[model samples]
Target: RRSKDIRFAFDRVFNEDATQEQVFAGTTKHLITSVLNGYNTTVFAYGATGCGKTHTISGTPDDPGIIFLTMRELFERIQATEEEMSTDLSISYLEVYNESICDLLLEDGGRGRSLALREDQNGVVVAGLSEHHPKTVREVMQLLLLGNKNRAMSPTCANAVSSRSHAVLQVNVRRRPRTASISSNVTVATMSIIDLAGSERASVTKNTGGRLLEG
Candidate 1:
């Protein structure tokens, strides 16, 4: 019998020893800074079930994750320039399930009202989605928690709390240089962070009934 070998290549790879700070420094820090400078950006995580998509995007509170870290930096930058710049920050979260779109930030008691996706000069946009402007990190985090509680999830043999839908969190930032000369000039940018549901094989997940349908 002969053994087959596999090989793969990527721009960069991190092992178990890679700290969350290190990962963010290498991957997300630039994007966060760019958003402040008026560049639209998006960061999305994709992988198979039981991989580390959620862990990397929304890790434990103590460990933090890309979302928390990026938001913190944004607030910090705003504060640093608050004396000379006026900044507006807002957030919106939503999920796509069963080929239908649902707004997570809606206070609709988890009834999962289907929203419509529209495309404009901004590419794709969700019509009638709730966008929250948070003054502090605590407020933004609270909104995130509320939205996450509405995400579609189910248990499977591959992993517990397996996501059944794709979730997106978008942060909108508008900055105005507050000088007496050009107080009306504003620069706007957006950052969309998405956490996609992992794909699962029926045989591997061994899901049944609703779980099977969800997977």
Candidate 2:
């Protein structure tokens, strides 16, 4: 479902099936423009376990999954727009483990309390969490792998190394309009790559070891 306030996207305009290259090119172009104009955006992924969340977010860099594609598109587009405008992009990646938030790249560093569920003034979830800043896509990707390595997992009759935590990879794009003729407010856009924990139960998983340790 689309948010009532957000009315811009590449897939909606380009129609991915129509032309992948042009679509990719166009989306990157919009992202660059949005960043310069002070508009924040987020590309988030959500779904049940084993639904290709990891495959989508952290796929091989060469093969290029969504995150990689977006990063490449962003930098490439920014480079392309260097003649006209300038922009800045920052990234942060973290994992929610047993309701606790931790830095994916740091050595097991986290907060005092676990993630708490809360609502903002608008009654929307502001959720409990702390975030870290990542400078490069390589840093973000490395932290993702680190988090995956640390992710709670277990063996069942079905599969091995099942993800036991929810991971959130966030990208914050900051853009300042060059001229006052247009809206000059600094705008930020976000892209969130979320990998959720598995839905299987303890009984179903018959978990032990790291899983039991998580238990």
* Top model number, lDDT: 1
TM agreement with the true structure for every prediction:
0.88, 0.63
Instruction: Compose the digit string of candidate 2's lDDT tens values, residues 59-131.
Output: 6656546666666667776667666554677665666775577665455544444445577643433253444
Candidate 1 per-residue lDDT, tens place, 23-42, comes to: 88878888988898889999
Position 148, candidate 2: lDDT = 64
Candidate 1: residue 132 Cα off by (Å): 0.4
Model 1 error, position 213 (Å): 4.8
Candidate 2: regions farther than 4 A off: 1-48, 109-136, 179-183, 208-215
lDDT over C-alpha atoms for residue 64 of model 1: 82
lDDT for each of the candidates? 0.84, 0.58
Write down the TM-score for model 2.
0.63
